[model samples]
Target: MSLLLQIETATTSCSVALAKDGVVLGFKQINQRNIHAEVITLFVEELLVSAGLKYDELDAIAVSSGPGSYTGLRIGISTAKGLCFALDKPLIAIETLEAMVYGIINADQSAISADTLLCPMIDARRMEVFTAVFSAGGTKIKPTAAEIIDANSFADLLEINKILFFGDGAEKCREVLGAHRNASFLPDFVNSAVHLTQKALEKFRNKEFEDVAYFEPYYLKDFIAGKKAV
Candidate 1:
């Protein structure tokens, strides 16, 4: 059994899941910002107990390395790295936006047959988002961005077919990008531990693991700390 523990704290969601062979066995999650640090470990404990497994039994650990909240990503990656060190397991670092796209593709394989593109967006504040373009085949047509999307952020991609937009940041792009004839919205898509777990397992088998000590969240943009007058 390829038992993997997955963690996703890229946005407001705090999630942890346990999976074996790409099948989710247990998951726990919350959609509140600023709680990942406090709740993630607890959720992990709960998930393990629920799955009738021990922490030492995990074969590997996976974490959503981000294009989302700066603080959230730090907390998640730190925790994941710590666990990997303590448990002596490989660390699978999955991209935050890419993981969201995988969730969409896994959810509906049929959506792509009609030429629908999956665009996963994570809010980056002040009208910006951490986003990327993914084709139905799970290829990254566009790399992740820290873009202040407007009427033409993805004009080229939108021209091909209707794009399915989701994640916490998706709704905010409506007034700007939603006017396009080829833009569509899926309101309830949020990152989940279950999706993270499955994606991690696949990555592990493909030797996609990263160095635990050096792995860091993909905070697409530089985290600009606010300055105060001296």
Candidate 2:
């Protein structure tokens, strides 16, 4: 049985999960601002202990490589890389948005129609968001991009397919896209490490691992530092 440790700190959430054969065995998570650095390692230690597993027994470490928070991504990836280096285990990188979509599908499979589109959004500030579109079956239809939301943002796609929008960015988008006939939103959906299990297992089975020393989070846009008030 393959044992994997998954970490997701892409947003305000700091989540960790231990999985065996694509199923979660233990999970610990918290949604708090700027606590990723403090809790990520603790959560990992707690999950392993709770599951009665040792770090050496882990097959690989899976991290949510992101298009989300810059600091959060850096903290998560650095932790995952350190674990891989110390344990001599491979690293599995799961796309943040893809995992979010997977979580949505797993949460309520029956509610999604074959033609329904999945739009996973990570708030990028103001009216812009990091987003991508996926088919109900988990196929990527639109590549990830930082988009400025507006009334006509997804109008063309909405004309042909019903789109399900969720995640932090969706909350602000509802006021703009809510009036559309085919637009549906699930504001309660949140990202978690548990959602990384299936993808991590698949990558492990396929021998797909990131270079421990060189791998980095997928920060889709360049980080722009804000100016401090004098």
Q: Which candidate's TM-score is highest?
A: 2
Which number leads on lDDT? 2
| Candidate 1 Cα errors over 4 Å, as ranges | 227-230
Assess candidate 2 and give its lDDT: 0.94
Worst 10 residues of 1 by lDDT: 108-117
Candidate 1 residue pairs in clash (backbone atoms < 3 Å): none
- lDDT digits (tens) for residues 52-136 of candidate 2: 8899999999999998999999999999999999999999999999999999888889999999999999999999999999999
Taking all chains together, each candidate's TM-score versus the true structure is 0.94, 0.98
Location of the lowest summed lDDT over 10 successive residues in candidate 2: 45-54
